[model samples]
Target: MISMIMVLNQKGDIMISRQYRDDVGRAAADSFRLQVVAAKETGTEAPVKRIENCSFLYTRHLNMYFVALTRSNVNPALVFEYLFQLIRILKAYLGEDFDENAMRNNMTLIYELMDETMDFGYPQNCAVDVLRLYINLGNVRPQDEPEPSQLTSQITGAIDWRREGIRHKKNEVYIDVLESVNLLLSSNGNVLRNEVTGQVQMNTKLTGMPECKFGLNDKLVIDKEKEDRKPGVEIDDCTFHRCVRLGKFDADRTITFIPPDGEFELMRYRVTDNINLPFRIIPAVQEEQGMTKVSINLKVIANFSDQLYATHVVLKVPVPKNTAKAKIKHSFGRAKYEPEQQAIVWRVKRFAGKAECHINAEVDLMPTVRPKPWSRPPINVEFQVPMFTASGVHVRFLRVYDKSGYHTNRWVRYITKAGNYQIRI
Candidate 1:
């Protein structure tokens, strides 16, 4: 819960303020401005700060700080979630690049939205779609405005995410399973960190209140089967959308929900076991003739199936900051020395699986006045492979039931990309 919400500029000047309770006074604003922003204290870098009895929880968007003040002991996670949701709602109303000028132009509209989204220090309905039904920037006559009773009902309704009487001529659904692979390899080829995070995104355009039951090849689900149990992905943890019925999922491991219209992420999961890395990078750097020149050799091998391929593969290998010039050659793809980046940047448009590529670079270093040792930063790699999942996660089945009994079309896709993928030299 919050006592007041304030939008302050980068200089700690209050741009907007809304008070829900009188327990927290205007002095709280000055406390944050002086103690947190003006002082720029390095004792604590946390988003939540405590000054006196009031707790200040805040997040920065663009050039403004959206701060929430509270006197009661509030759930930090919930407060942060509400802050982010507020940002999403503002972005929906305003443009993606909304800044100080945009907020100054729409001050009244912003106040109205803040009033409706939160009431008496408690978060109310913050759904953008639901709020858009009643609130608008354009002027409307009394007769043209939606009924107040209906708006109240929608706000308090169980299915606040979806509006009633939603109809579409063609009913169809699309599911995309996207995964990000993160790895940290030691110089001696030891696997330091390897993990995969994935999310299931859905785009649904269906009529009526259709109930959908989704299934996945999860280890927990497969382990419950007394017979014909198959190997499944070992999921460390998962989080679902608000529309999902958590009770049903807890009882039977069934993902049941009346999905929201348009596009939304259905679920996100993390996996640390049995991750299939798509690429193996081997790098060697040797100084030649008393650090006058350095020779760098890098080999990249695709580890996936031969039928698959990665697109827009890139690698960045760092060089000494005192390097003057470099000559590079590669078996495949393009390589060039970037003086500004102090690294050799190599890129390949399309790389086939079961293939290997090599790059060799000879860098000449200018003697530094201080003669400090090179830090030798890690090599970073980036790529995207379609129809692949590092966690081996697969959709088992998706069933839909509706009163209209109309035929529906469904499609599923999978993709995996690199994230924080680094190899030490």
Candidate 2:
């Protein structure tokens, strides 16, 4: 009889024979039975029978195979490193017989493993190492050398192009790979190569387009000319189009006329619905100056066309100034003038058994003195006088005024000596 022993070690459990006994022995008999069944079913080689058994060598070989297969299921990083190192070792020892498939697989595996690991947290050194490995595996040719299209090179270029878009700092690398791809595709006469190149060139040209505009819009052109146009009236000259006045008393109303050129005119006058009146003009004689005084003569009509209260009429006249005293004689009364103040005050009385109206006014003269002199020290004097009306009415004229009364009042007189009085007894 023979014995079979089962052993459990660090690698795994195995069954062993203690001796190679006769075919009739139980251990040998069981082995032969399993071989007979396998040969009968599949018609293949039967199990081998060892004449001498070595447990240590068998156990060693079994553990080595088991460990190799187990490591295949481990993390790819370790697998990649192992395979990479194996390629290097094989290249060093086995020389040209080094497995190209194994090297390529390991290089690709390293790249995939690095990408996966860095998905959660980037590892710069690992990524660089993977790139270096790929470059080495692709066997990058020198600039002068013409090499055949390699699978590894094509895959590496694609990987680097994608990485360039992600990491813009590697833009040169992306461009280089793209150029290589173009060169390859162009060599193969690919249609897509021409299309992509044309598009890139077109985009580059568009980016360099001119930034400035040349012509103006219509509104802007019109506004530019309009800005330079001048206003209708000159600034320094006096201008008048029409005149109108409203007041309570007819005698209180006075118009002072300072002739612009030596004379002026009241060209047109109209009276509307406010009064049933006809407009007229009157001239009075000045005894001292021998000048004719101009005034308005207005008379009330018994029946008029429009309403009696509201009136609107146009009076066209040249521009007038207040300098010389004048009077407005009305049917109702008369008003007095203050020459220095450029104003009028009306006076009323009964004349020819009816109420008559009159006005006295002072007019302003055009400024003869330059505006700068008024700020200096000045001497002032005041006086008064009384004059009688034609109806024996007592009236007073006061001249408590300045010599430089207005800009138009020139230096006509100056006091030379101070008057003093002395009495001797």
| Model 2 clashes, total count | 18
Candidates in order have lDDT scores of 0.89, 0.23
RMSD of 2: 53.8
What TM-score fits each model? Answer: 0.93, 0.12
lDDT of 2 by residue, 303-403 (tens): 21122211121111111232354544434443445454333433222222122223223233334343222121111111111111111111011111213
In model 2, how large is the Cα lDDT of residue 200?
Answer: 6
Global lDDT for candidate 1? 0.89
* Residue-wise C-alpha lDDT for candidate 1, range 1-425, written one tens digit per residue: 79999998888888788999999977788899988888764235889899998899998897788899999999989888888988888898898878988888989989999998899989988888787878787677445344778767767889988876778989999999999999999988899999999999999998988999999999888888656366888899999999999999999888999988888899999999998999999999998766779899998999989999999999999999989999998998999999898889999999999899989999999987677778899999999999989899999888889987889899999999999999999
Which residue pairs come into collision in candidate 1? Answer: none
